[model samples]
Target: MTRSAIELPVTADDRRIARLAALAIGLTLAEAAIPSPIPGVKPGLANIVILLVLLQYGWRAAAWVSVLRLLAGGLLLGSLFAPGFWLAAAGALVSLSVLGLARHLPDRYFGPVSLSVLAAFGHIGGQLALAGIWLLPAAALLKLLPVFAAAALIFGAVNGVIVARLLAGPVSSGRQSGSCTPPSIP
Candidate 1:
């Protein structure tokens, strides 16, 4: 694969975004250490960082952070270009798109939790769809949708709560919402 070259130097904001991506990547690695009863059922702890980035820096920064985490985490886990990476990339893309749309909703009607839930469902849906089209390609895979949805709902709510709490903190809101500030890491 050909890589693109950057003509400009990395800015302070880029460093901050890299720090956020590193945090998400760390969580992804740690989550990988835990065993799940179901193959695709994981709490998605790294999502908290993505959701936080979304609320603070908008969908563009969140997209960057999510992609960085996936690439870095996949490489670290030796899952790059594997089936898992394709599933993860699809999920991340869907989740980012969901966040992009959800962010436009009135603040009074929906917040991080709602947005998180939407992204979570989108994430799982994307993975399931990809699995159906590529990996399994069987009607039996459809049976797992409900299970994945349940996991997404539960884990999404938990992650949403964590992100909401982070947003509630003074450090993450106000003047620093659009820029990276040293907020307390959860």
Candidate 2:
């Protein structure tokens, strides 16, 4: 069987989303390559891209970037439909939800750093909840909360700072005038 299509031209926004998603997936794959000393602790580098999307475009673009990363990255990492994927999906869902609400906050009070931290905590919360209810279903699993929380705080802050720097740098601009092109995939 062959597929047929009335080919539609991709818009600038479409190209931007695709590029951002590709960058996010690339970051996810890169992160996967680094061996972690702690089982559930990584820098969450992909989130920096998502956060940038949210800041530049909106929650919708960020959501697209996030869901695409979760699905595509999982497939690339050979973790699709696996326990890790579910956990990551759950975390992304909660983080996006939190970001949707938090975006309403004034920029002065809530910038990338604060937003990143909030989303990070939300991500961890969702993962822990899913693990407790579905995977382990034991109170013992809750014991890991503190460790995860600490990791979230540290990584979230770092990711937020990175995003902020990216935003301030020329990369946030639409053009590649300087050494760093804007983080928008296109």
Candidate 3:
């Protein structure tokens, strides 16, 4: 869908937001390229953008940006239907949901770190759920929860810090400018 079709106001600010999303997609792809100890696990650095969009633009913008990132990233990487793609898609959906819910809470209530924790846990849970459905038995998947959780915690916190840094300036400026209000705290 075109930018105008998304119901977001077509001001310069909206264009700026779109540009930011594109940048986030690029960042995510770069993050994905970094080798990890486990093949499929990632730091989910791009999720900071997703969280920021959800906070600044609203869920619809966040969701659409996420879908765009997933599709574009998969196509660019040539991993559209690969197992990793499915895992990433599931994780993204879960992370988006968590961020959506978190948006309801006052910004000061949770902080970026806490939101990242929730998103990371949701991301890992989604992957585990997919694994159970498409490959392993539930019992087998359960065996890996500890490992996944640990990775999620570490990566999630890292992503959260990055996001917090990125948002601190823009969000505060937006608030001061009366361009937006902090989302309600859940």
Candidate 4:
């Protein structure tokens, strides 16, 4: 008797990862398109997607998406080595690190909202660090920190809300499928 072979379809997790990566890239472009009074400041909307990816998929996938977004944004905007690119790379690295660490916390502690907030702070801190390294020494732009911090707080809250909402549906579905893992607390 000849037996027929069956093909297994791609898992939901795989589909989710692809979708999140695409979303991250799209958001990155949108954020990049927004004009800032100062060149280095951004809403970092893409970080929201990165945070969601880290929460739902894993750090590896999140890192890949972040790097892709960074490179693509730089290429699209014709600013590969511009100070803004460096600032963005710094922010992305810091935020991704925070998300990776947060992934280890107990789910009851952080959740999406808190995780978003932590990631935002890390993003801003990274930008500040980069600015200090590249621009602050000249004293020409040191006065911008307060404005940058305020923008970070406002945009961070917005990104946090977007992440929280994106994760809600997945959390509910994962719970139903018995595939949900409690996210790390902040």
Candidate 5:
């Protein structure tokens, strides 16, 4: 018997998310090329896309973008299910979890910069915790925490400011609430 082909319904939202995921994957690949003095201390450039999606779409869409990035990035990098992949996965999950809760916060104080910082810490904290449990010892994590925390703060703030500026720009400022399409990024 011949097997029938399966076709999934793809909406505009689906296509948009795919594009965003591709952006994230590109960032991830670029990040992998950057040299880091400390292990697991990359700038987490993909998260910029994730945070942007979270602010514009919601946690659900952000999560989809993040997961797709992780899976596709891992596959492209040839590190699927590897230790590096697990560490990144742990970080992304925690970062998304933080955004899910933090989105309920008022827009005044918890704007893109603040939320990005929170997600950054969450990502680094989650990665260190998982690494400690699965790969390294507690002492190593403690030693690495200061460096990772510093990196998280700096990178998160930068990414957040970028998103905030994007949102504040003339192109994005006119967006109506509940709009699904993102503004044309310059």
Candidate 6:
């Protein structure tokens, strides 16, 4: 008996997301190189890509970029299923959820900087909550809150500024944003 092979078609949009994910993963690896006195206080350098995708493409593309980055980055760093991996996963979930909701906010009042700040808090909060539940006691987590919060706010704003600047620049001038619907998967 012979078995049939299944084929999946690749799209340009898929390629775009893959390239963005690879960039984000590269940033994650770069971030890992920085020394941090605190366990999870390193700047979220990778988030700049995600925020840019969210703005230039949409939340769905941004989410895809983030998911790919997490899986690939975890594998590359040899930290899959580790405590740090779980913490990052938890943080991504919360941050993505916040972005999903925040995307609905008005353009007049909200933009990348504010959204980034919000998602950063969500990211840190998720990590802290997970640490409190799986790694440390609530009280100890509380002791660590201020440091993490400060990191989240500062990093979030900085990443936001970077993304905002990149958006303002001619990074991808050929593409239309927000006003158009992203190409649907066939």
lDDT (0 to 1) per candidate: 0.86, 0.89, 0.79, 0.75, 0.88, 0.87
Any idea what lDDT model 5 has?
A: 0.88
Q: In candidate 1, what are the lDDT values of residues 1-186, reduced to their tens digit?
A: 977785778987688789999999999999999999999888999999998887777788888899999999999999999999999999999888888988888988788788888999999988888898988856777788789888999999989888876765565434545534436433
lDDT of 2: 0.89
Better of 4 and 6 by lDDT: 6
Give the poorly placed runs of model 4, Cα more than 4 Å off. 1-19, 138-142, 170-186
Query: Comparing 1 and 2 by lDDT, which wins?
Result: 2
Q: Estimate each model's TM-score.
A: 0.86, 0.88, 0.79, 0.74, 0.89, 0.88
3 or 6, greater by lDDT:
6
User: Each model's number of backbone clashes?
Assistant: 0, 1, 7, 3, 0, 0
CA error at residue 99 for candidate 1, angstroms = 0.7
Higher-lDDT candidate of 4 and 5: 5
Clashing pairs in 4: 105-184, 110-185, 110-186
Q: Which residue pairs in candidate 2 have backbone atoms (N, alpha carbon, C) closer than 3 angstroms, thus clashing?
A: 171-182
Top TM-score model: 5
Model 1 alpha-carbon miss at residue 56, Å: 0.5
The sequence of per-residue lDDT tens digits that candidate 3 reaches over residues 98-170 is 8888878886778888888899999888888898999889897787888889989998898888766665445
Candidate order by TM-score, decreasing, is: 5, 6, 2, 1, 3, 4
Q: Give, for candidate 1, the lowest lDDT window spanning 10 residues.
A: 173-182
Deviation of model 1 at 98, angstroms: 0.8
For residues 50-153, could you state the per-residue lDDT of candidate 5 as single tens digits?
98888788889999999999999999999999999999899998999999999998988898999999999999988988999999999978888889999999
lDDT tens readout by residue for model 4, 1-186: 977698768876657666666777788778767788876677877777787777766799789878878887788878887887898889889988888898889989877777877777788788888888777763644677677677777777787777766554454534633434544322
Better of 1 and 6 by TM-score: 6
Clashing residue pairs, backbone N/CA/C < 3 A, model 6: none
